[model samples]
Target: MKIVTIFVMMMHITGSLCAQVLQDIKLNAPDMERGLTIMKAFGKRASATSFSSKDLSLQDLSDLLWASAGVNRPENGKRTAPTAVNAQDIDVYVLMKSGAYLYDAKTHSLKGVIAGDNRKMVSERQTNFANAPVMLVMVSDISRFRGDDTEQKLIWAAMDAGIVSQNIGIFCAGTGMVTRPRASMDTEGLKKLLVLSGTQYPLLNNLVGYPNE
Candidate 1:
């Protein structure tokens, strides 16, 4: 007769998988000018940094996810990043020192997933993922596409992920956070680890954290 919230059960598994209580919180609106942020991103777009030991707060994590793909126009429910035909298939899953969460763009909140401090497994070993406190794993659910061709859906997914991925870079640059988006992942392996659905395909892993001196 266990009665615990999904988040609590997914943040820590220290002999109590369902011992914690976690829920989504409202994200803080970014306090930067859009045009200025874009300009700054373009300036250092090529000089990306990665592998940092600094960590980000939950609020910082919330802000980054929202900037990357949260709903921008609530009237029409448009996202920060554009999707092909507005499919909006990309899903941003965040890995923090605490746990992993699936970002819900519409609500601008995080849905807890795997429990325990498994964020390190989000990327391959010998990579900079360990240094960064947050890693955004972009996944696209092809079922959202109207088309039935799996191959075509995957292509569209990649394109959609690219746009969202760049948004992370731009946001990090403008906000003074460091990020490095990389495709160096074993898609199938990660899918299994995350227990992703058959139609959901991971696109890229964007590392985010504070810069080191």
Candidate 2:
């Protein structure tokens, strides 16, 4: 009887700890008509405004990041965006006011990439990050492609990264925020900043923020 009681207590503690650590998160919004229509309204138009430096909630950030590249459909492990040959070579590095993190598609969580708020490293101009809340650095491990032509492979990978980037832009539009897929970045600087030693190249960056109105 004493052994049974102790085992039950241990099980309860374990369950509570698991619940605390593994949070269940999902996207919530103001219904489809209101949300989807607005999101679709912007289509391909990049945001014209900039976001103010305000702390966004975990829900907001999670949904935004999920919309960027999270897996939507279940069957084949496909995501909101398409990848060339489904190689999924593109990796998204999220630089926020706190630190840098990588998107774990399978776990639907942000894993630490680097331990610092190095948003300025993403852009030379401080203004670029001044009103920004989150900046996603799209990287590609070019070696993943076993194509005969290396340059063409790089081009195709870049194309895939662009697809995912556009999704983020559209998602921002839906949420009444601002976003811009910026190619005007110091790639080498970013690679070093994010501590990308070899082959992991920062291809593009997308800046997101709540519009300063």
Candidate 3:
């Protein structure tokens, strides 16, 4: 009877922990009026050398993801960043201290992927970058592209990923935030952590935060 009681309590504790870790985040609408002008953002755009550890506000995070690759044209379901053949191959995974989430462009929200801090996998050898409050890891699912040539599909994936990363850079530059696009990360570890399929490849990542001033 005592053993049975202890097992039940342990199961209850595990269930509570799972609930805390896998909570989905419904993002807010993007603030259309915010940020600097296109020219100003272009001028200010530069790679950040350091980042603050402070977490971003819900609004800022919402805007950031929307700008990254959210659906800009609601009428046709088009996105801010264009992909080759409109494949929409790139997927942005948001890694924070709390958990990892996949940005659902159609719904403009974050779908919880896994629980616990996985930023270390994105930071990899650049341990310093782990301090950034948020990390956006870009993964491309080549299977989305309708092509027989695997090599050409991979090329398109790279280009599409770069476009999304650039959007992230410009948004940060204009919005008084800091970010740096990088190719360094534990790809194999991320694949296992995120449970990525064989067709999905993590190509790039961006460390995002306020300047450590």
Candidate 4:
């Protein structure tokens, strides 16, 4: 009887902990009027070396995601970043202090993936970037491409990931935030943590935050 009672207590505690995990975040609509002109943004586009740990405002975060790859055309469900053959294979996973989330472009919200601060996994050897409030990890599921040529599919995946990363860079430059695109990260660790399949390859990431000035 005592053993059973203890087990029940443990189960209750576990349930409570799971309930405390990060929940889905409904992102705000993209602010079309915000940001600098395209020419000005291009002039200011530069990778950030240092970042502040302050959290981004909800509006800023929403706009950033939308500009990165969110569905710009709701009617056809097209994204801001173009993909080869309209594959739309790139998926953006958000790593923050609270937990990791998968961006659901259809709903314009962040779906909680796991309940932990896995930002370090994305930072890898670049410990300096671990402190950034948010990191966008771009993963490519090559299986989305309708082709038997694995090599060709991989090429298309790389190109699509690069385009999305560029959008992130331009958005940060146009706005006041800073970002740096990187190809380094703990791939194995992220793959396991995110429960990704063999076809899902993590291609790039961007550490975004306010400048550490």
In model 2, the clashing pairs are: 51-210
**Model 3, runs deviating above 4 Å:** 5-13, 16-21
Provide TM-scores for the models.
0.83, 0.78, 0.94, 0.95
Task: Indicate the residue-level lDDT of 13 in model 4.
Answer: 100
lDDT of 1: 0.77
26-63 in candidate 1: lDDT tens per residue? 56665445434477667865434555676786667767
lDDT of 3 by residue, 14-102 (tens): 99877667788999999999999999999999999999999999999999999999999999899999999999999999999989999
Off by over 4 Å in 2: 1-34, 38-40, 126-128
Error of 2 at 105 (Å): 0.9
> Model 1 — which ten-residue stretch has the worst lDDT?
15-24
Q: Which ten residues in a row have the lowest lDDT in candidate 4?
A: 15-24
Per-residue alpha-carbon lDDT of candidate 4 for residues 27-122, written as tens digits (9 for 90 to 100): 999999999999999999999999999999999999999999999999999999999999999999999988999999999999998887899999
Q: Report how far off residue 59 is in candidate 1 (Å).
A: 4.0
Between candidates 1 and 2, the lDDT winner: 1
